[model samples]
Target: MWRSLWRSIDRFSPQYFKYILNELRGIKVVERSNRELVIDILQSMVEIVTYGDKHDPIIFEYFMEYQVMAEFVRVLKISKNSRIEAPLLQYLSIMIQNIESDHAIYYCFSNGYINSIITHPFKFEGGDLASYYMSFLRAVSSKLNRDTLCLLVKVELVS
Candidate 1:
């Protein structure tokens, strides 16, 4: 049943992604009103985007046009209390790891979005958070190559 549903993705629409992105953007991280909802939305967004990357580049591009990567970073920064950090990292890692296309990977790694999240001073005291953090790092590391190197490092003129 699950595989059938997963494979029957022709009905999936970009409007679904846009609606979820709107919900994600509206979520107030500090307020505990919709914590579980936020996590669920993150998982859905990642799943949709990952599947779209492999099945339909147009759907993935539509999601990216909304600046989802940068929004994820903003959510991570505001979610300093670790309420949703672990799951966010886990989903992010999963998403990044599943990106198969070089163009899609470049879109994710571009604009220093991933760099900001990686270098952010996240409170990694808990085992789960630390583990997911490392997982996220490993996922990002796997995507690194000569083309994506510029996204992570800056070359300043010293002269």
Candidate 2:
């Protein structure tokens, strides 16, 4: 059954995945008022990352090569609205949590990409959005080691 599922998944050619990813990348989340589209995009991203295994680097490589994280960061940078930022942040949080490779995780943390998501500098109105950020922080803190603890401390203090 698992092999059959894998075979079914394999039928999605690399070109097809690229086309879908390109379309997803093209979405302007900050400018669009369509809430459904935002959900769809984020959900699609979640599904992609979900399919990956902890030892599998293929999906992770594709994400890095395609610069999907950059797009999420771009949305956060250009938009002050939490409604827009929350989903993007959640997408990033999932990425942080599910990432299997130390190299990928290190790049995200060291380069300040994950920091930006954590310390968003934007105010959330109802405390709802703040909770989401807090959840992400907790997950990250739990996963921290001695080296990353220092960086996490600095980021938490600054945030």
TM-score of each: 0.87, 0.70
- Across 98-121, the per-residue lDDT of candidate 1 in tens digits comes to 989988898898888888988888
Counting clashing residue pairs in each candidate, in order, gives 0, 0
Q: Give the poorly placed runs of model 2, Cα more than 4 Å off.
A: 1-17, 53-56, 80-82, 147-159
Which ten-residue region of model 1 has the weakest summed lDDT? 4-13
The alpha-carbon deviation from the true structure for residue 127 of candidate 2, after best TM-score superposition, in angstroms, is: 5.1
- Model 2 per-residue lDDT tens digits across residues 1-159: 778766544423344446657766676655556655665666666556545435445765676677766666776676535367667666666767876666666555665666667766867777577877877787677668876655545544554
Q: Global lDDT for candidate 1?
A: 0.83
Top-TM-score structure, candidate number: 1
Q: Pick the candidate with the highest lDDT.
A: 1
After superposition on all CA atoms, how large is the RMSD of candidate 2?
6.2
- Model 2 score (lDDT): 0.63
